[model samples]
Target: MILTRFKKGDLFVAVVTATLLLAAGAAALIARAGAGDPVAIVIVDGAAVDIINLRDARAEERVYASALGTCAVAFEPGRVRIAAADCPDQVCVHTGWISRPGQSAVCVPGRVAVVVRGDRAEVDAIVG
Candidate 1:
C-alpha cells in the first residue's frame, strides 16, 4: 500500500484557506441576521430626542415646537425619522430611515445621536 503525505507548507495553506472560508461564512451570517433592527436612542439634555430603528419606512413626519422640549424621534414599522428638534439646522429631520444594524442619525445642536448596538449577550467569565 502506498500513502500520500501532505507537506508542512501544503498543510498550512489548507488550514489558512479553511479559516478564511469560515470567517467569510460567519460575516455573511452576521450581516443577514443584523438587517433591520432598532439599536439605540439618542437623548438631549436628559430627554430622549431621537429613536433610531434600522428599518426602512414609507413615510416620515416631523413635528417641531412642542412642549416636550422640541426634539423627538419616532419609528413606525420599518421606518425611522426625526419627529422633532429644537435645533435650527434641522439636519436630523432629513436623516430619514436607517434599515440596518449599526446605522445612526444625529442632531448636533440638539445633542442627540442614535446608534445601533449588537444583540449578542455578554460572556462575563469562562468556566473550565
Candidate 2:
C-alpha cells in the first residue's frame, strides 16, 4: 500500500503540509491580536468611560450606545470603526477604521472619543 511506503517524496509532502497548517494557524492568531494588541479606550469629557480589547472585539459587531448620542461600532479582524453615528456632521462615522495604537475617532457632538491604547512610545508626540 502507498501508506506503507516511506519514500523521500512522501516524507517531503507530509512535512510541507504540516508546516503550511502551522503557518495558517499563526496567521489567524496574529489577525486576532492586531498590531501591538491595542486596547480601545472610550473617553468621555477627559474621563475614561470604558476599555475594550481590539483583538478580541472582532468576534462580532457591536454598538457603543451613548446616552449623549448614538454610534454603531464594528470590529473586523484587526481594525474597528464607527459604522454609523447620529452626529450631525457624520465626521466620526466618516473617520473609518482604526487599527493601530494611538489612532482614535472622536465624536465631538456625542462627547465620546475612542482611542487605541498600547505600549508604543510617542503616542502624544507632535511632529512636523
Candidate 3:
C-alpha cells in the first residue's frame, strides 16, 4: 500500500461541496413539485386561440379551421398531440405526443402551434 497525506481543510471543503450539491438538487425537486400543472396554448395565424389545462383535461379532440388549412388537436390528461392536419408535410401529426412544459408541436403549412406552458415561470435561456 502507498502512503498518502491530505491537508486538514481538504476534507472540510469536500464535505461542504457535497452538501451544496445535495441542497441544490433538493431545491430543484421541490420547485418542480410546487409547480401546480402545465397547460397548452394554441396559437393560430400568429394569435393565441386557446389555453387548455392538461392536468384537468379529459380525452378529446378539437378541430380548428383557418384560411391555410384545418388541423385537429387531441388532448389527454397531462399530454397533447396533433392528431391530424391538412398540411402536406404531416410533421405535426408525426410528432406523436408532448407532455412536458416548454414542449411544442407546430404545423407550418397550417400556421398552427401548440406550446405547453408550466404554471411556474421557467428560465428557458439566458442571452449574453
Maximum-TM-score candidate: 3
- What are the candidates' C-alpha RMSDs? 10.5, 12.0, 7.0
How many steric overlaps does candidate 1 have? 4
Q: List the global CA lDDT of all models.
A: 0.59, 0.75, 0.87
Residue-level lDDT tens digits of model 2 in 1-78:
877877999899999999999999999877755445677877766678667777677555666655588777777676
Off by over 4 Å in 3: 1-35, 125-128
The best candidate by lDDT is: 3
Q: Could you tell me how far off, in angstroms, the CA of residue 72 lies in candidate 1 after the best superposition?
A: 1.7
Model 3 gets an lDDT of 0.87
Residue 50 of model 2, lDDT score: 69
Candidate 1 lDDT, tens digit per residue, 22-105? 999999888768543544555655576545443443354544333334656666665455766777888877887654445556
Model 2 misplacement above 4 A: 1-36, 121-128
lDDT of 3 by residue, 1-128 (tens): 22266666878888999999999999988877846588889999989999988989899999988779899999999899999999999999999899877788999999999988886747452244
Cα displacement (angstroms), candidate 1, residue 84, comes to 2.2
